[model samples]
Target: MKVLKPIYFLLALFLSFYPLCSRGEMSAGDYYIYADSVNTGGVISGGDYGVRGTFNESPIGFTTSTSYETRGGYQPMELGMKVSASSLSLGTLSATAIKTASADAIVWSDAGTGYTLSIGGVSGTSIANVSDGIITIGSEEYGLSVSGVDRAFTNDRAIAERLILASSSEPVTNSKTTLTFKASISDTSVGGSYSQAIVLTVSGNF
Candidate 1:
């Protein structure tokens, strides 16, 4: 009976460990599918991913004569511009001028005698819009109305106050636009060689 008791104890121990060995030998597929059901929670929302974008603008190539000879009459000068823009908001173009002297005195000490600079243009882009009337800048206002068409350009220090020569919300790639700057001087104006630096600015929103 003592020998039979030892044999029975060994049999019981083998039976207890048999189920554990079977569970450890489970296949990879069966273990993953049956082990706690892998709660994915649908899309697994988190801030680990994101979306982004970018924009670019090419230098506005302006071509024109370096000097102009205004012989006391309406002397018209022209410059051409080609714009390449990648933006979602409207692209804007403007020009502002600063004389060597003052606005009223293109030539020093010449009160009430100065040359007038005006800008105008026709857009090459079909969807682009140009100013149609005299756009005012600060206290000064100028007109670019010519030939029954009101293609005007405003002069101001503020970019918001400046005129929009050409604009469109869509991207403009190498769009050709012609800008005509007409300078008029009266015969009684100062005799010195007067000059003004005209600054052209272009911007696009993204």
Candidate 2:
């Protein structure tokens, strides 16, 4: 009797287990991790020297030195620098000469006739041991040229068109002399960055 009762009990237990493990009706849900987060970041920046050109608004003047071997004393000299306005011009903006003040004499040697006038570095003209002076701004040349106007009369000359020199009391000597070159700048002159070096070489018979 007990064995017959156990058979029905076992059948009931199987039916209950089947419903928990395998169901005909569908039900769904997502499971995920719980999280807390933090984040961080950074940045950087920097500048420098820019491109520039030379602006010789006024006469830029300086001097060279002269030394004598068996000289009794020393002498001072005078040299003239002239700015030539070449045909090159960007509209009304033209290139002008920047003349530095008189520098000391650079001596070379004597030709038996006289002392040879020499300079360290100079630009502009074709300088000989006896002739014109060469004053340069970087690669720019400054020699004698018509100020784009007439020097025949003073009144006809304009500032932007000529370079005027002050009155001189003496000629070039062994010592250094003051020299100035004047010019007129235009409103149309290009505005921006600039830089340049000027070199003046005065050569003559001392």
Candidate 3:
């Protein structure tokens, strides 16, 4: 009986380890909401202020000349935005991309309308519903600053270069893309001033 008991214990131990050894590993399946970390890529394209069209300093305010690239690392990239200020009230707002001198410089042609800055959302995702909200600051409301703020409202009717992905048609896969953002305030009444920094949050599977 003692010998039999010892054999039974040995069999039980082997059975316990057999399943573990034969266990199957996991496999990533299709259509997964892959929560990949934020792999930051690319620097902002334009930043040097130039006088071109509208101002005595030049029509173009500050032009960011750098083209943003995808941050090195993972996939399934998504995009988000934030404002440097809690609120933004301004004048004739507008945004434009920096044009290179090269006649054949292939710049993005589809400059969608500029969208509004949110606490945590995108301004324009659809072509028809592009609205960054227009604000008319009277001469009295000049230089109005807001806090907890990290974004601003733009008069420019164009999509932010950073939020503009390489493929907006569907499941975002491409990682190597350039982006930029430019804005200006021309509220004549009070000599308008824009407040807050606009920061973007890009995330997705990577």
Candidate 4:
């Protein structure tokens, strides 16, 4: 049987916003109002210490992390995602032999609190998501592995439910996540031309 498998990945993105403070405020005991002999401003940094900025008693959106860097000014909420190839093809299938293919997901986001990456199997035939498993040919297995931060496909998961594949807690510029798809077939497994369609949706966090 000349078994050929192709998986297509589609990209989608969006942005979100949080309620902004009506007015900014200053933290307690913080010298938010500095009047220097030569200059004066609402903020000042001295020695090796400084402030991260204080606004209304308002809170950070979604979550907070000291490990995450902060950016000043109004940066338009932005997100971009693309797959190296719209489709990944696994040549011919051989019994007891695993066929592997890979695609790269490049993402760029400037949204506060970073962004999320999710994937769902829009369509498939003769193959199933092996999510976190190694494809065993004779076993007729199919699955994938994602390499990058916040790897979420660590167990058998329903790809039809649009599961989060990976994420970043901080804005990323041209970040790359590699998705390696593995598949195998059995001599007894019914197969002809196999194919699957996947949609990868990227949305910015608050």
Q: How do the residues 64-155 of candidate 3 rate in per-residue lDDT, one tens digit apiece?
A: 44784333322222343322334333334433222111101011111132222222334422212124432222211111111111223223
**Model 1 misplacement above 4 A:** 1-161
Candidates by TM-score, descending order? 4, 3, 1, 2
Mark the regions of model 4 whose C-alpha exceeds 4 Å error after superposition: 1-76, 154-158
Over 4 Å off in model 3, which ranges? Answer: 25-178, 183-192
Q: Candidate 2, residues 32-113: lDDT per residue as tens digits?
A: 2112111111111113322222233222233334753332212232344332321222232124534332222222222222
Q: After superposition, how far is residue 50 of candidate 1 from its true place, in Å?
A: 17
Output the worst ten-in-a-row residue range by lDDT, candidate 3.
99-108
Residue 165, model 4: Cα distance from true site in angstroms: 1.2
Candidate 2 clash figure, as a count:
25
Cα deviation at 132, candidate 3, in Å, is 14
What is each predicted model's overall lDDT from 0 to 1?
0.30, 0.30, 0.30, 0.65
Query: Candidate 1: minimum summed lDDT over ten consecutive residues — where?
Result: 100-109
TM-scores of the models, in the order given: 0.26, 0.21, 0.26, 0.59
Q: Candidate 2: lDDT of 101?
A: 26
The Cα error of candidate 4 at residue 162, in Å, is 1.0
**Tell me, what's the RMSD of every candidate?**
25.4, 33.5, 22.2, 22.2
